[model samples]
Target: MRIVEDLRAELGDRIVTEPQVLQAMRTDRSGWVGPGTPAVLVRAASVADVQAVMRLASVHRVPVVPRGAGTGLAGGAIGTEGAIVLDLSGMRRVLEVDVQNEVAVVEPGIVTDDLAAVLAEHELWWPPDPASRAISTVGGNIATNAGGLLCAKYGVTRESVLGLRVVLADGTLIGVGRRTVKGVAGYDLTALMVGSEGTLGVVVEATLKLRRISRDPVVTIGATFPDVIAAAAAAAAITASGLRPAALELMDAATCTAIDDLLQPSAEYPVLAGRGAFLLVRTDSAAAADEAALAARLIRHAGGEPEVSTDALTGERLMQVRRSAHPAYARLGEVLIEDVAVPRSALPAMFAATERIGASHGIPIPTIAHAGDGNLHPNLVVPPHLAGEPGHIPDVVWSAADELFHEAIALGGTLTGEHGVGILKRRWLADELGGDVFALSERLKAAFDPLNILNPGKVL
Candidate 1:
């Protein structure tokens, strides 16, 4: 209560104590709700506003939950009870664009896709495009160190981030990283903050490295296989053969079916209809045509029927199917999205494991993958009766997720690929990181946030 008064006094009308607003902020897209209601929500309009909130929170020893567009799928941006919801979505501004240097300075709240559109005018591009780019913010992507369809070639958000201007737990503003193309000056604190998920500090600004938009003709290859295993194998083969595609995505039989069903009678090309599994590949380099042809050969070798196209609209339509996987699943019932990744060579095994786990659990785990990088998003569709509330996940679902997480770990993979270890996956983080390393991570977290006031009860 005292913290709320302090926040209101410092922030004036920017402070929101309305119960409805607080309730709306209690959960992110993760479907995992916080245990209690947020004490207040602050619509931060600038870096100074963020600093004010954090400074007051530190003085009161109150928890501060930094939030972007609330598109996080790992509960990283969820607001907790007695915590200040530091909403940064309003601070959407592009401060500077150094086109000569191929770098841009931007506010954290700028939408990923919006930034891309702005960059396009300059003939530049930022390639870390998550499926939720239309709504997800740059800050949220940086918080999770997000990867997307093109990650196999361009890498994740961290690779493009040259530097960060962060507000520490004590509200001290500090800048980390460099703008130079090459610098090995000190510890990579910018890298450390990239995936810290708001546990270390609040990211107010980022200096991002940009690339010139490719002018080469784009080639898209759509392939169908007997099953997910075959499609995953084809993807693995393409990766092994050193063919770098701008994007490589795989959708299992169930995912294809769901997307097909969603795009019914008026659908122009029903390529996904009755398909067992589908692979969407795109190559946009100088040798895109040659690379796509070789990729098609690999697909054929893997027992798949491949269709290659150079039409940009056709390519976008195919990509639309891949991007529509989650919404199609959500139409069925309550959806629990799971992010797990394995080595490229182990993709088939992981797909096989999902089949077995889904059968054992008696739940349909419709999966899609950024196959080029071996990251799979398995959607657990829980019927209305079983899925009671928005944030409530049944015990059986958790059991299945536990088995899936262990399976990934067994295959020399990780519990999460792009999504950070928010409340949803924090339980298994120790299993993946081991005891000693996990303990050291906690110590490092303490060194940055001694009061444990930054995103408490999250990411260790």
Candidate 2:
């Protein structure tokens, strides 16, 4: 490209046009190939590098897709044809950790766990614990408004964000939100940008809210029920009992069996061994032991064998398995993870519908969930041979997914709970948001990015 040559000449090796680099930067972790490889990969070293790339892209009318660690599962960071993959992973820097203000300033490229580690040194922590914290960037977490094991109690990334430094599509840099805790200054543009999927603007840096770690509870509880519905019943009971557990997770038989098999047999992994459906509950309040005891008795009353533990190490190992649910599903085969959420009271009905869907489709769909919040991840696994066949793979999986998504909607639930509606779920956005709201969302997108060059086909 003659237009790209100028960028190459000016940026030197910073602007990558090599085929291998382009190929390597093409897709995200969505398990699907992009429509086409990127034309150039810009390893942005600073905010200025990003602004220069955006400026050039705006002038030439080329698409620009902002990317962090590419650990996204929704294809939000995947590059489009002839687009510039603006890689921000090179800009990692923790600028400041303000204990007095309970905030930390850092570049977008910093890994989520790294920021948590830094805050831990100051006796403070950020609680959003996405399973991919080791590999996912804070920018990507903010982009998707990620949730994790502890999110039901601690809140998601959007709740923890204080401010953002974003580069608009036309190369304009601006700050949104505030460093302080309270402010109703305007229309909450910072919240708007938090989950825009890089379609609105490129996030360069962020001011993150932190919290002091609590050691009150020092106890964890585990239980196994006859099935997912029974486990969900126990979860609903726990929630109804007014016992505020910090984390509440659920795993079905298949998910637990696979995780148990992958980890091999061990005494510490009994939470996953021979458990048809399991629930993990943790509390950090002063009533920790009481909460665990009450929760355990409720699980028993709900027809489950309760496994109570004050041993932190054993509980941590079990929680690690819950965190590894998605990865364990990946080991099965080609998978499409469905992020569906229903009312807590309707979880049993949701599981019944899921079972019916699996039975009807003849697809082995393993489910794991943040049961406390009623968010379930139903993983559709396709065999290797079927994946290569024409139409069989997506045809089967998508048909089942359509049924499952509609079931969620029918139950007064949502298409996605934690995962944003990226490429994979864009077609269903209108169905979820309805005509008027979805149309307003389109207007919002146009207002932020008129040319639709930022993350071209994601979200609205």
Candidate 3:
């Protein structure tokens, strides 16, 4: 209470201890479990405000949670008891854009889509287009090291970031990385900080690497397979054939039905209806048409019907459906989103295992994948009637999810591809890293925040 009074006195209305506001800031999109509500909410307007909050929280040895837009799939943005939620979504500003040097300096609150729009003006682009980019913040993307459809050709958020302005646990502001294209100075702390999940320090600003927008004509290929295995095989064959597409994605039978039923019940949107598996492949290469033709042929070889399109509208509609897949499921029931990734070659195995797991667990799992990269999001749909009822805990659902995670690890893959290990997956992280490596990770956490004040109970 004294801390609240002090914060309100110093920050005025910027520090919100109101019950309603605190309740709203409790958790992010990962609604598997409700969060322990924090006592203070600081809507940070500038770097100086963040510094002030961090300084006070450090002095009092209170936990601090940094949140951006609350679009994160992981529970990384969930606030804990007695903590201060440092909301950075208010600090939206594009500080600088070095066109010649191919870099843009931005505030943490800037939305990914908004930044892309600004970049378009300079004929430059940022490729980390996560499905939630329309609402996800640049800071959140960096925290998760997020990857999207284009990640197969370009890379994740880590690749596009060059420098970061961070605020340490003790409220000390420091710049960790360089803005130049190549810099091997000291340690590569910038890379370390990118996916730290706001545990090591808080990101205030970033200098991001930009790419020039491609002028070559792009082609999109949509295909349907008899089963997910066939689609995945086609993806593998495409990759093996050395015909790299700009983006390659897959939606399983149940997912295709769900999307079609939700978006276009009367008619098929993107022609995804009545398909056991759907694949969308896009290429912006110099030989874009040739690559698309080859991809279509590969689809045929793998027993799929390919639908080629050079029209931007139709292709974009296909992509829009893929992006909207996750949210669309939320309308049906309690959607337990699972992020598991395996080797591209082992994709067929992953698909098979998911089917077996779902059958065993008696849960309906609809999966969609960035097939080119082997990242799959399996939506475990819990019927509306069964949700939040007494003794109806979705432990049965997680039992299947447990199998999915282990299967991914066993197949030389990770429990999470783009999403970070927040509260949702921390239980499995130790198993993935082994004891020795897990201990070393804990040491890194200790070295950064001796008091464990920054985003406590995350990552490590």
Candidate 4:
């Protein structure tokens, strides 16, 4: 209560204590509610506002949850009980675009797609295009080190982010990283903060590296296999063949069915017609045509039906089917979206393992993958009765997720590929990182946040 009073006094009308607003900030798209309601929400409009919030929060010893567009799939941005929800969505601004230097300086709250649009005007591109780019903010993407269909070739948010201006727990402002393409001056704190999920500090501004938009025509190849394993194998083969596609996506049979059901009566794009599994590959390099032709031939060799097209509309339509996977699953019930990554060569085995896990659990785990990078998004469909119940995840679903996480680790992969270890996956982080590394990480956290006032109960 005193902290709330202090925040209101310091921030004037910017601080919100309304019950409805607090309730809305309690959780994110992950649907996992925080333990308690946030004491206040501070809509930070600028870096100064962010600094003020962190400074007061440090003095009051209040937990500060830094939030962006709230499009995060993990519970990283969820507002916990008695904490100060520092909302940065209002700070959306593209400060500078250095086309000659191929870099952009932007405020954290700028939408990812909006930044892309601005960059597009200059024939420049930001490669980290998450599925939620339309709504997700650049800050959130940097916080999660997000990856997308293009990650296999272009890399994730960490790769695009060259530098950051962050506000620490004690209200200290610091900048990390370099503007140039190559610099190893000091510790890679910028890289660390990219996926730190706001635990290390609050990112207020970022300098992002940019790439030239490929002018070559895109060639898309759509293929259907007898089953998910075969399709995954084909994807692996494509990667092994050393053909780098701009995007390589895979959807399991259930995912295809769900997409088709969601987009019903669309005669143009029937998602495999209840076939087995689907793969969408797009190449946009100078040799896109040749690469796509070779990829199509490989798909055919792998017992798949291949469809090749050079039309941009057709490519987008095909990619749309892949993008619709999450929404389609959401239509079924409350979904526990799982993210895992494994070695490219082990993709088929991982798919087989997922199938086995789903069958053993007796639940439908419709999966989609950025196949080129071996990152799989398995949607665990919760029963309809439990749908929309805040803070609820069935025991069975957690059990299945536990098994899936272990399987990924066993296969020499990670519990999360793009998504950070928010509250959802923090339980198993130590298991993957091992005790020594995990302890070191804890020390680092303590060094950055001695009082533990920043994003408490997250990513330790």
The local distance difference test score of each candidate is 0.91, 0.85, 0.88, 0.90
Cα displacement (Å) at residue 272, model 3? 2.0
Per-residue lDDT tens digits for candidate 1, residues 302-384, read 99999999999889888777778877887878878999999999999999999999999988899999999999998887756
Task: Report the poorest 10 consecutive residues by lDDT, candidate 3.
Answer: 384-393
Candidate 2 vs. true structure, TM-score: 0.97
TM of each candidate vs. truth: 0.99, 0.97, 0.97, 0.98
**Which scores higher on lDDT, 1 or 3?**
1
Steric clash pairs (candidate 4): none
lDDT of candidate 2 at residue 292, scale 0 to 100: 87
The alpha-carbon deviation from the true structure for residue 353 of candidate 4, after best TM-score superposition, in angstroms, is 0.9
The number of the candidate with the highest lDDT is 1
Which digits, one per residue and each the tens of the lDDT, describe model 2 over residues 269-295? 774656779888887788888888999
On the 0 to 100 scale, the lDDT of residue 16 in model 3 is 82
